[model samples]
Target: MSAPFVLLHPFAPFPLARRTRWLWLGVAALALLLIAAAGQWSARREASFQADSIHRAIEVHALALRGAAAKYSYLPFTVAQHPDVLAALAHPFDPAVLQRANHYIEEVNRRAGSDALYLIAPQGTTLVASNWNTPRSYVGQSYANRPYFSDALAGRNGQFYGVGQTTGEPGLFLSAPVRQGAEVVGVVTVKVSLQPIQEAWGFVRDPILLTDAHGIVFLGSVLPWLYQSRRAVAGSDLDWVLSHQQYGAHHSFALLPWKMDPAPDLPGFRVQTTIDGKPRQFLAVDEALPELGWTLTVMADYASVTRARERTWMLGLLCAGLLLLGGLYWQLRERRFAEQRDARRELEVRVRERTAELDEAHAFRKAMEDSLVVGMRARDLDGHIIYVNPALCAMTGYRADELLGRLPPYPYWHPDDVEQHWHNNDATMSGQAALSGFESRVRHRDGHDVLTMVYTARLIDAQGQHSGWMSTVVDITEQKRSALRQRQHEEQLQHAQRLASLGEMASTLAHELNQPLAALSNFASAAKAFAEQGRQELLVSSLDETAAQAQRAAEIVRRIRGFVRQRTAGQEDCVVGALVANVLALLQGEMRQQQARAVVRVPADLPKVRGDRVLLEQVLLNLVLNSLQAMQATPLERRVVEIDATVADGRLHIQVADHGPGIPAALAEQVFAPFFTTKPDGLGLGLNICRTIVESHRGRFTFADRVGGGTVFTLELEVSG
Candidate 1:
C-alpha cells in the first residue's frame, strides 16, 4: 500500500476556519471595491461614446437643416430682381401686371419647392402671391405689422419663422427688399416648409428640437413639444411674439416640463423630462445654427448608459466567482485535456472530408459554367475582367487569355460602339444596369459584328459582400435580324395604308378645288368682258377678284399636294391654330356637302407643339372626316363639329367633339384596334393609324363621351418650350 494515510494541520481546526472566513471576507470587500470602480469606468466610457455619437448626429442634422434653408435663401433675392415683381409693385392696381407677377411667382415657387412666394408693397399690402388663384390667396392681405415686412421695408434682408395667417402652416420666411435706385419699393418673401426636416428627424429614435433665439421650439421631432418654450416667456419677448403673430394667435407659449444638469462623467448634459406621464432621462447635445439664430438639440437615451454600468458590475462579480471556482476545477483539467485531444483528431478528419467535398462542388460548378451556351463573364468593382468562361471565348472568337485582365474598350467591343460600351460598363459598375438587360454590338475576332443581349448582376463573395459584377451575354444576332425583317414588313403595310387613305380622299379633294376654280373662271370672264367694253374701273376690280380666286385655287392644290406627298418622317414646332385651319380647309367641301358646321375654338396664345406637321394634319383630317360622316344622320341645323384647343400644365390639349350619336361603350376598346371598323365599307385603319402616329410623336390619343351626345377625341401633346 502507499505510505500510511496521515492528516496534518498547520493550526487548530476552529481557529483556522475562523481565520479563513475573515480572509474571504476581506477578499470579498476588495472585490466589491474593484467592481464598483469598474462600473464607474464603464459608465464613463459608455457616456463618452454616446456623447460622441450624438455630437456627430447633431452636426449632420444641423447641416441638413442649414442646407434645406440655404437652397431657398437666394430665391427671395432672385424674385426681387424680377422685372414683373417691380412692375407689379409700381402698378399694384394694374391687373395685367399683377397677373404676370403672380404667374411668375407661382412658377418659381413650384420649381423651387417653396411653400409661398409673394411680393409685398411698401405699405405692407400683399401685391401678388403664388397662390393668387386659390381662395385662401395672400393677395390683397396686409402684413405691415410683421417683422419680416418691416425689416425688408427698412432696406435690409429679413428672415423670420412663423405660422401663416392665411394657411395656418408654419414655415421659415426669407425676405429681400425690392429697390428702384435708392428707394425701397417692395419686399419679396419666400416661405419654405420645415416639415420635411422635422419628418426626417422623426425617423430617428432620439428627440430632436430646433429652438429660436427666444428659447421657443419652432420645430421638433416630437410634435407636442413644438411652439413650447424652454423657459417662461414674459415682458418684451412675450409681447413681441404675440404682436408679430410668430406662433399664431392660439399658442399658449407654455414651458416644456424638462430640466437639465451637468452630467457627472459625460461630455453633454443630463436631461430629465416627463413624457406620456413617465419620467425619462437623456444625454443632450446642442449645436447652434448661428446664421439662422437657432439651436438644434439631440437627446439620446441615458438609460442605456445606466444599463451598461449595471452590466459591468454584474460581469465583474461573475469574474470573481469564476476565480473562486478555478481551484475546484483544477483536478479534472488533465482528464479533460486528454479527451479534447481525441475529439480534435476526429474533427480534423471531418474537416478533411468537408474540404474534399467543397473541391468537388467547385469543380462541378466550373464544368457547368464551361458547358453553358450563353457567355459568362465576371469583373471586379474596378471593371477589370476577372473571369471568362470557355463559351464567352468562343462567342467573341477570342481566347480566355486574351479576354482576362482586360479593362473596358475591350477587344470584343465594336470599334464604332466603343463609347457606348464604355457607357454601359460604367452604368453596370455604378449598379444602374437595367433588369431587362441591354443590347450591344460586339466585334468578333474576324471583324464581323455580333449582336448580343447582356444582363448584369452583383457578384457576392462567401461573406455576402459585394465583390464585382457578373454578366451573362446571349448571342441575339438572328433574333434581331428576324425582328428587323418583321418591322420592315409592317412599315411597308403602313405606307400602303396611307396611300389607300389618300385614294379614298380623292373625291373630296376634287370637290374642294371645284368651287375655287369655278369662281376663278367667272372672274376671268368678267374681266375680259370689262376690258372688251373699255371700262377701266370695272376691269381693274374684275382682275383683282380673278387674282384672289386664282390664289385660293392654288392654295387648295398646294394643301392637297402637301397632304399626299411622301417624305421621311420629321418633327418640328407646329402651331395648333394653323393645324386646325388646314384640317378644316381640307374637309371644307365635306362639311358643306353634309350640311355640318365647324366650330373652331383654338386659343391664339397656345404654344406650338413639336411633331411632324403632315402627320398631325393627317390625324386631324381623319378625325374631322369621321366626325362629318358620323353626323350625316343628324338634323342639318344641329349637326356641328367643334374643335377646341387649350394649354394646361405645359401640355397642349386638342379635342374634336361632335353632336352625333355617341360611340357605344362596348366598342370603345375595339375602336383603336387595327382592321376593326364600324362602317360597312371602312378599312378600319383610320383610328388605329391616328393613334399610332400620335403615340410615335410622344402624344396620347384618347376618346370619351361628350357632355351632350357625342364622342370627343382628345390629343394631348407636350408644348415646345
Candidate 2:
C-alpha cells in the first residue's frame, strides 16, 4: 500500500467511504484504458497523414526527373530527324557535297551542345564530322562495323546510350536513317551529355541509388562516410526486402527489424512502402528511363519516419487523457458519492493544516526576498507588473506601491535603455529565448544614472502554463565611473606628450625645412644655365624637376605643422605603411644628424586602422628619436633602427627596436609613467605619451628591454577589418 493510503483510517464515519472509493477506482481504470486506445488510434491516423505527404513528395521528385530526361531525349531527335542529309547521301558525294554536309553538322551541333555529330554515307564511309575528331579524322574513316552506323544503314531508326571513345563520358547516342524511295541512304548520329540528368537527381537530401532493370546499381551519389563504410541498399536490409513477398509487389509496406552493429542504434524504424524492381521507394524512382535504360533514386532513413509517428502518438495521448478525465468527473456523480463524502471530510482537515503551512511559507518567502541585494521585479505574461521587491524600489528610489502594475516605459529606465530592456525582458516572458543575463542602465528617481546587470527567468503557474518573468538586477554605477575617469586621464597624458615631442624636435624641424629650399635654389640655377645655352629640352625638364622638388618641400612643412598643431579630436582611416612612410620622410634629416640609418619594414599589405595621423606620427617620431639617441653612443655599424608594422589579434602593431644597448630591466614599467625618465635632461613624457596616444586609438603600448642593450617599444592600434 502507498504511504498516503496507509495514513487513511477506516473509522466509523469513513468505512462506507473507503468501500465507495474502491468502486470509483475501478471506473477510473476503465476510463483510462479507453483513453489509451483512442490515443493510439489518433496516433495511427496522424502517421498515415505524414506518410501520405512523404509519398507525394516522392512522386513530385520522380516527375521532375522524368521531365528533365525527356528534354535530353527530345534535343537529339530534333537534330537526327532532319532531311537535308538524306538527299546528299543518295548520290556519291563530290567535295562540294561533302562540304555542304559539314554545314548541316555545324547546325545540329549548335542546336544541341553535343560533343559528337557526324554523317555516314550509304557505302558505310564517314563523309563529314563535327566535334568527332580533329580535322574530321572520321571523315574518310569506315563505319562498316559500328552499331550506330550499321543499324541505321539497315533501314532502322533507333537510339543507343554508350560511352564516348575520346571523352569517356556517359553519352546518349541517337541515330536516324535518311530514306531515298523507301530505302536507307545515310545515318545521322547525335551524341549529347548526360551531366544534366545527374544534376536533376541531386535535389534529394539523402543518398540516391539508381539500378538498371537487371537489379544492378549503375548510378549512385551516396554519403562519403556511408560509402566508406560500404553500408548501402545492397546490404542486409535490402536483401531481406528482396526476399519478402511484400517487397515484390508494385506497392506494399512492411517494417523489418535490423541491427546497426558498429554504430550505436538510433530510434528503431517503422518502414513505409517497399517494393522490388518497381520504383515506389524514392531510391529507385527513376530506375528505368525508356530512352536511356537508366534509373534515378533517393533514399531516406526509416528511423525519421518512426520518430515522427512517435511524437504524434505522444501528443494524442496527452489530449485524450485530459478529455477522458474531464468527461468522467462530470458524468459519474452517483458512483462517486461515498467517495466524495470522505474526500470532503479529509479536505476539511487538510485545509486547516495547509493554511498554517501557507502562513509559514509566506514568512520564509518574505525573508528570502529581503536578503536579495539585486533589484527584483516580476511581470505577468500580459506585460503588467505584478510585484517589485524592496531592492528594486531602493535602486530606482521609488516605493514598491509606485512601481507595481505601472506598465513598461517605466520612468526608472533610461530612454536609450528602455527599448532593449523591454525586448530582452519580453523574450524571457514569452518563453522564446533562454535565460541569458544582460546588462543595461536605468535612471534613478533622483535624476542620476544607475548601470545594472540583470538576470531573468520565466515563472510557471499552478496549471503548468508559462505565467511571467522574474528579473534580478544589480547596480554597476561605480564600475562605470571608474572607467570614465581612467579614459579622461589617458587623454590628458596623450595631449601633454604630443606637445613635448614638438618641443624636442624643434632643431630637427629647422634642418628638415632647409632641404626643399636648397633643392629649389639648385633647380633655379640649372634653368638659368639651360636658357643661356639655348637648350629648350633641358629647360623644360629642369623646370618640371624643380616644381616636383618644391612640392616635396611643401609636403614636409605641412606634415610638421600637422604634427605640432592641435586639431579637433577625431579618428580617420589611414593605411599603417603609408602613414609610417610619411613620418620617416619628415624625420630623414634628424636621422642623418645622429649618423643613424633607419630601415622601415612595414609590409605593403598591412591593414588600415582608425587613428589620428598626427598623434600616430608623434608616437613613431618619439620611438625613432629614442633609437637615434641610443645609437649615438654605439659604433656606426650598429646605428640602424628597424621600424616594423604588422597586424596581430585584429589590431596593428608598430615595433621599434634598435641594435644599441637595451633599457635596464628595472625601469621597464616605470618608463610609461608621467615624468619618469632614464636620460639626462629628459622630461620622460615621450613613452608616457606614446601609451596615451595608442590607448586613445583603442590600443596598447608596451616596452621590453632588448636582449642586447637598447630598448624596444611597441604600439598597438585596432584594425576594424
Candidate 3:
C-alpha cells in the first residue's frame, strides 16, 4: 500500500535481502554525513566571499570620506593668505576692514560649498564669519577653549570634527595660522558639512558607518545610529569628548546594543543586533582612515549566505535520496502526488487567511488615522495631495473629497500666506523642509485664522523608495492664547509691583514736595512785599527764585507720574547719566529722611543704552531704595549710598554701593527669589522685579559683597551705537 512497505515486503522472504536492507541503511546515513559536510563547505566559502566584498566596500567608503575632507584641506590656508583676511586681522577693531573681510569670506564660502569661513584673532575671538549677517553670527564668539584653535595658535594646521558651539550643527573644522613673516598673526578656519556623504550612503543596501577614533558614529546610513558609540565609552575618552564638546553636549553617547563574535570560517567578524525590532546578523568589515583618525565600517546582511547554504544542502539531499531510494520511486509516485495536492490546498487556505488579515490590518489603520486628534495629510512628489484624514478635513472645515488631489495654494491656505505655503510646499518636494516643524497660519471656512504647527516626514513605499511627504499638523491656537494670557498676567503683576513701590515711598514723596512748595511760597510772599515797597530789583530776584522752586517741585511730580503711569512698553536710546539722576531725584527725600548722603559719579560722556527708559529708571530706583534700607542701621556718618556709572567694552555698567551690613552668603542667592527678603515689612519683590526688568532689556543684574563689609549691586547693559 505504501512505498516503504512494498520495498520491505519484497525482501522479507530472503535473509540476503535483509542484509541488503541493512547495507542500504548504512549508505543512506553516510550520504547524509557527506551532504552536511558539503553544505558546511559551501557556507564557509560564501561567508569568505561576502567578507571580502564587505572589505572592498569599506575601503571605497573610506576613500570617499577622505576625498571629501581633502577637497577643503587647502581652503583655510588659501583664506589665511588673502589680503582682506590679513587686513581684518591686523586691525580687528576696524569696521570697514571687517566688513570687507566678511563679504569676501561669504563669497568664498558660497562658491566652495562650505558651511562657514571665519578669521580668528590671536586671542581666539571670531573677527568675521561668512554668516555674519545671520542672527546666530559668530562675529564675537570665543574659541580659545577649542583644541583646533590652540593647535593653530601653535603654528600648525589643525583638523577636527565637532558640533559648532554657536550653530549647534555638526561639521568638520579645518584651521590654518595666518603668518606675518615668521610669526603667526591669526587663525583662519573653514567649516564643512558632511551630511551629504551620509545621505548618499543611504542609497546603498549595506549599512555604512563613519566613526571617530573614540568610536562615536559621526555619520551613518542608519540615521538613528548616528552619534551613538559602537562600544561602551567612559573614563578619559568620555571626559575628552565632553570637555571638547566633540559631539555636542546634548548627545549622551549611548552604546549600540551589538554582540560581536569572530566568524568561525570567515576573515571578518559576525555582528548580531536588532534592527527595526527584528534580530539580524551581519558580517562586519572595518577599514581604518589614518588621515582623519576615523574608521569606516560596512555591515553586510548574512541572510543571503544562509539562504545559499540551504539551497546547497537541499540539492545534495535530493541527489542522495534519489540514489538510495530509486527502487521505491515508482511505488511512491502516487503517494507523493497526493501529498503535493494536499500541500497546494493548504497553501491556498493560507493565502486566503493572509488576505483576510491584511484587510483587517488596513481597517485598523484607517480607524486609527480617523481617531487621531492631530490632523494628517500626505502629498506626492509632485505636491499633489494624495490623502487626508478626517481630522484634517474637520480642522479646515472642508470635506475629504475637497482636499484630496489639491496642489499648492490650496483652499485652506491663509489668504495672506499663500505664497509662503507655496514656498514651503516646494521645499518639501525638494527634500529641504526643516525636520523640527514650522509654525503657520491656516484659514478656516468661517473666516477665522487658526495657528498650526506642522511636522513633515518622508513617505516610503513598499519597495523602500521615497514616494512623497507625510505631514502631521497640530492646532496650536489654544496654546498660543494660553501663552498670551500668561504674559498678560505677568505684566499685570509687574505693574502692581511698581505701584506697591510707589505706595511704600508715599511719605517720602509728600516730604519731598513739602520743601519745594514751602520755598516757593516764601519767595512769592517776599516778591509781593518788595513790590508793595517799590523795590523793583528785589521783586525781580524774588520772582525768579519762586519760579525756580516751582519748576523743581513740578520735576519731582513729573518723575513720580512717569514711574506710576502704565502704558505699552517702548524701546528708545536713554542716557545712562540721565537715568541715574532721575532715580536719585526720586529718592532724594528718602535719603534725607534716613540721614544718608547720596554720592553720584556718573560719566558725562557715557553712551546711551537702548531700552525702555521708564523701566530702566524703575530698576535703578528699586536698587537705590534697597541700598537706602540696608543702611538704616549703620552709623549716620557711614550711612552713605554711592552711585557710579561707567562705559567700557561697548557696555554700560552701573554700581550702587552702600556701607551697611552685608547680605549673608546663604541669603545672597535667595535675595533675588520672589517673596524672599530680610526685612520683616518687605514683600521681597524689589530685587526680583529689578532683575526681571534688567533682563528684559537684555542686561544683567548682579550683586556681590563689598570689600568693606557692604553690598555692591551692579547692572550691565549694552550701549546703543
Candidate 4:
C-alpha cells in the first residue's frame, strides 16, 4: 500500500461528506461548460454578422464607383459621332475643320466636367485637347502606344486607368472610334481624373480599396493603401508597370513591406503592426467589384468583437462565482460530522513515520558524501587513516580500499610535499596549531602533480574527545593556469587595439590631405597665370581664397577625430545625380593614377536618398578607389568602372562595376570580417566601414561577379519621399 493511504486508512471520515463535495464540483463544472458553449456560439454569430456587413459595404462602394464612372462613360462615344470630328478626321490637316472640332470638343468637355477631351488622328497623334491652355496639355502628344488608342482604332470602345504620359497624372482614359461612313478614321478620347472618386471614398470612414485587374490599388479610402499592390509581384511584371509609369513615380505594389499573417481557423486575418510607435491590430476582408473588373478590400476595426467576447466571459465568471459561494456554504455545514476518534491509532502512525524519516535521512547523507566533488578524508590522532569517502579516492585516482586506513605518508602525497603533509598532520593531532587552511600538491594515479586546496577539522566522538582530523581537497590546476593565460591575452589585446587606432588615424589624415592638396595645386597654377597676365587684383583675391581653403583642409582632420565616438553621421536628403557628380569629382585623381575611365549613369528624376553626405562620399570614394586598384594588373585601355544608379521598389540601387579580375569564391564570405584582407597592405576596413555606414542608414550592400568577367558591388539605399 502507498504510505499516505496506509497512514490515513486507519482513521476514516464520513463517506457522505465526500459524496457531497463531488456532487457540488460536478454541478459547477457542468455550468461552466454550458457557459463556455454559449459564449462560443455568440462569437460565431458576431463573426458571421461582420462578414455579411463587409460584403454589403463592399457592394455599396462598388455601386458608388460605377455611378461615378457612368457620368462620363458615353462622352467619348458621343464626341466620336459629331459631324465636325468626323469631318476633321477625313480632312487630316485642314485647319478650319481642326479648329471647329477643337472648339466643339472643348465646349462639350467644359459642360461635362471631364478632365480632358482630345481627338486622336488615325496615325495616333493628338490633333486637339480640351486642356490646351494648361502646362500639362496633350495637344501634340503621341498616343500610339496607349491600349485605348489601339482598341479604338480597331473599331471598339475601350477603357483604361493609368498615369498620363504627357501630364503624369493618374486618370481613366476612354476612347471610341470616329467612323467616316463605314470606315474608322480617327479616335475620340476622354480622360477623367480619379482624384474625385478617391476623395469621395474618404467620407466612408473605413478602409476601402479598389484594385484593377492587375491587382494594383489605384483607388482607396486609406491614404497609405493607395497605389499599393494587393499581392507580391515578380520582377518581370513589376517592370512592365514601371516601364509605363502606370501610377506616376511610385515603386512596389505591396500595401506593407511586411506580409500579413492570416488568423488560424478564421475567415479574416489579424495584422499587428506599429502605428505612430504604438502597436495596433486590424481585421480585413476582401470582395470583388465584378462590374468594373476590380477587387475591393475593406478593413474593419475589430475592437468591438473583442469587447463583446470580454463581456460574455465577465458575465459567465460572475455567475460561476455565485454558484461557488453556495457550494462553499454547504461544505461548511457538512464539515461538522467528519469522524472524530482514534487518537491512539494516529499516535502510532506518527511514530512509524518518524522512524522511517530518520532511516531515509541517514541513507541520504551517505549517498551525498560518496558523490561530492570535493574529497573528504578522516585520520586518527596516531596519523593512521580511519575513514575515506569515494570522492577522496576519485580525487587521487585511487580506490577507497587503497586510501582508507593508510598511514600519514600516503601514497597520493606528492614526493616534494611529503614532509610538509606529515608536519601539518602532527601539529593538528597535537593541537599546537588548530588545523588551519593550507595548499599542497598531490600525486594522482596518472603520475601528474595537481594543485589541491586543503582544510582540516576535528572529528570528535559523542564524548567530545578528539578522535581524528577531517581533510577536504579540491583540484585548482585549471583555475590557476586560466588566470595566467588571461593576463597575457589582455596585454596582447591592448597592443593590437593601439595599432588599429594608429592605422585609422593615418588613413584619415592621408585622405583628408589628398582633396585640399589637389585644390591648392590648381589654385597655385591659376595664380601663376594671373601673375603672368599682370592682373594684380585677381591674383590677390586668389591668394586669399587659397588661404581659406587651406584652413578648411585642417578642419577635416579635427572633424574626423571628433567623430570617432559618433557612429551615425549627420543625415540630409540628397539628390542622386548631385551625389554621383560630387563623388566623381573626388575620384578624378585616382582615375588618372590608375589610367582607368569612369562612366556614370543616373536618371535626372531618380528618387532622393537620406543619409550623411560626408559619410556617403567616403563610402563611394572607397569603392571607386578599390575598383581602380583592383584593375592595376589590367591593360590600361581596358580599365573601366561603370557607376550605375536606378530607383526600383522604393530603393535606390547603386552599382559600381569594374572590368578586372573578380574575387575568388572561397574568400568572399571572409572579406567583410574585421582584420581579414586580400592585399598585403590592405587594412580590410574599407569594405567593412562601407557596409557599416550603409547598414546604419537601414540600407544593404552586396557584391557579385559581372557577366563579362569582373566584380560588381551593389549598394541599396532607402528613398526619401
TM-score of each model, in listed order: 0.56, 0.46, 0.51, 0.43
lDDT of each: 0.88, 0.67, 0.88, 0.77
Predicted structure 1, TM vs. truth: 0.56
Off by over 4 Å in 2: 1-361, 364-373, 394-398, 408-422, 439-451, 461-465, 513-554, 564-576, 601-619, 644-655, 664-676, 681-721
| Backbone atom clashes (below 3 Å) for every candidate | 0, 8, 0, 1
Off by over 4 Å in 4: 1-13, 255-278, 329-721
| Local accuracy of candidate 2 as per-residue lDDT tens digits, 184-255 | 767777766656545655565544554443344434453221111122344554544344311223121221
- Runs with alpha carbons beyond 4 Å of true place in candidate 3: 1-344, 532-534, 572-575, 600-610, 644-653, 665-669, 697-700, 716-721
Residue-by-residue lDDT tens digits, candidate 4, 595-619: 6898889888787899987667666
Worst 10 residues of 3 by lDDT: 326-335
lDDT of 4: 0.77
Single out the weakest 10-residue window by summed lDDT for candidate 2.
223-232
Residue 214 shift from truth in candidate 1, angstroms: 9.7
lDDT of 4 at 218: 84
Question: Which has the higher lDDT value, candidate number 3 or candidate number 4?
Answer: 3
Q: Residue 607 error for model 4, in Å? A: 32
For candidate 3, give the lDDT of residue 126. Answer: 97
lDDT of 3 at 114: 88
- Between candidates 1 and 4, which one is better according to TM-score? 1
lDDT of 1 at 220: 90
**Per-residue lDDT of candidate 1, residues 1-721 (tens digit):** 3333333343447786688688878988999999999998998888998999998898788889888788898998899988999999888899999999999999999998888999999888899999999989999999998888999999999999889888888999999999999999999999989887887887888799999989999899888888888898889998888899988865568988789899975666998997777799999987889999899999989999899999999999999999767744764675488768868989899999999999999999999999999999999999999999998898899999998899877999998998899899989999999999999999999988999999999999999999999999999999989999986775565566567666766777788778878988898899899999999999999889888888988988887777776663578999999999988887777777787889999888889999898889988988888888788888888799999999878788999999889999889889999999988878888898889888988889999998978889999998884
